[model samples]
Target: MSIERIEKRQGATLVAPALLWTLVFFVLPFLAMALMSLSHLEGRSVVSGPDLRNYAKIFTEPSLLKGIAVSLEITALVTVISVALAWPLAWIIATRIPVRWRRLALLLAVLPFWTSYVVRSYSWALVLGEKGVVMNALVGLGMLSEPVQIMATRSATVIGFVHFFVMLLTLTIYSNLIQLSPNYARAAEDLGASRWQVIRLVILPLTLPGVVTGAFLTFVLCIGDYITPQILGGNNELTLPQLIMLQLGRRGDYPMASALSLVLMLIVTLAYLACARWLKMERV
Candidate 1:
């Protein structure tokens, strides 16, 4: 074989496993779920059929619609807050921190991610619950007259999300930050630009790719999360993932649940495409 043919063969060999895995795991399961969503629930069992009832049910069900809205709201709020918080921290880590401490800082950013998701969510419950640490401390210091119920609130859900997922956002942005040369900002300063101007004109624009990536990941993960909302959210804070879980686990409505899952997947997929398009535009 010629050198080009050998290289082509090696490349194909490396890609084959990944392609097989995707087909077996992701593609096959997704196809199954799509077919399952079209099934009809008959008595106690779901029967295979061509039905638009599942999709219609999702649209007409008030509770499910509310749940989706709540999930999207939480995801959007968390994405904005997490990205804003990550930007400054990433800048410090990438530009200001000593080389020796950079690794340690990165580790610190990822430390929360090392903890179990359940444990982290429960820990937030402990801190934010009525008569919990925060409430007790506030009462002790006469900051409040009564124990404030922080858990089972929308705010608490967002807080828990930030606590656990902020590190991921920071690390994502930081990776891009480190790749950016400091000379742009330095040159801006040398040209008698203010700090804000340097950031707006040079740093912020350069870091937009990372910001978009981190926000997209955070939004997708947060919106799909069942554990955090289930643990922290009260009746009013119902989320889409929780609703899906309720349908599958509590109601045993597999067809409806599969339909809901597909809807969620479609939304995330659209957002992913939008992010990809934005990234491509930025590259251009």
Candidate 2:
């Protein structure tokens, strides 16, 4: 009857659509998958289960456990490399580049984004192959005695992931860096801080939120990606996504795939929580 009650009702009405969408699309499917994960395959037939056998197998089986480790290693390596490369690039664009050309510089930096993801991955596959341009150049320049096995390895996967994620990290870091006033650096210099010290102590500390956000995104995407690792890293080492695909495509083991999917989601959730907490602590 009153204006306050009317406003509350209007707010609830506005929120309802989004809540419904999430429930229908995300929540319902997740619940179904969770239920399926509890069940498992019995020699090409699915057996209903409240059993933990699949998850137990995931932990106990060496190959399955190795997939988790491989995913973590590659994701971590890509995140670290991306952040390291992106920060300096974002800094140069935000600080050193003229205002008129900053947009153009950013445009050039993210040009790879215009290409399809599968195309980029495959393109890298060609570039990293033993007889690829890189190896040919290296050998021609006498840098290597022969072409090496970079194509079907973890290095290739990391290179692909870092190439993609560096652009994303640059954008996030640049947004943060541009918002920072020049006065912060000037103030530190006025206090007799060196350029390196100003950046390490002041600029880097302030950009923690953006760095963590970018790193978290990189971790989630890299760990879950199947294309690059399958094409570049090969079947020599299975990442979690590769393992999930194997379960689905080969074994038709829906339960095992569901369980692996849940595990991947859990890892992403944990990363989100850690980043969220770190950002909260930074604010405090």
Among these predictions, the greatest TM-score belongs to 2
Q: What ranges in model 2 sit over 4 Å off?
A: 1-18
Tens-place lDDT per residue, model 2, 1-284, is 99999999999999999999999999999999999999989998989989999999999999999999999989999999999999999999999999999999999999999999999999999898888899999999999999989988899999999999999999999999999999999999999999999999999999988899989989988999999999899999999999999999998999999999999999999999999998898888
| Error in Å for residue 39 of model 1 | 1.9
RMSD to the true structure for each prediction, in A, is 2.5, 1.6
What TM-score, to 2 decimals, does candidate 2 have?
0.95
- TM-scores of the models, in the order given: 0.91, 0.95
Question: What TM-score does candidate 1 reach?
Answer: 0.91
Q: Per-residue lDDT of 1-284 in model 1, one digit per residue for the tens? A: 99999999999999999999999999999898899999968777888987888888788888888888888889988888888887888888887899999999889878877779999899888889987899999999999999877789999999999876678888888889888887888999999999999988898999898889888989888989989988887666588888888888776988888899999999999999999999999998
* Residue 167 lDDT, candidate 2, scale 0-100: 98
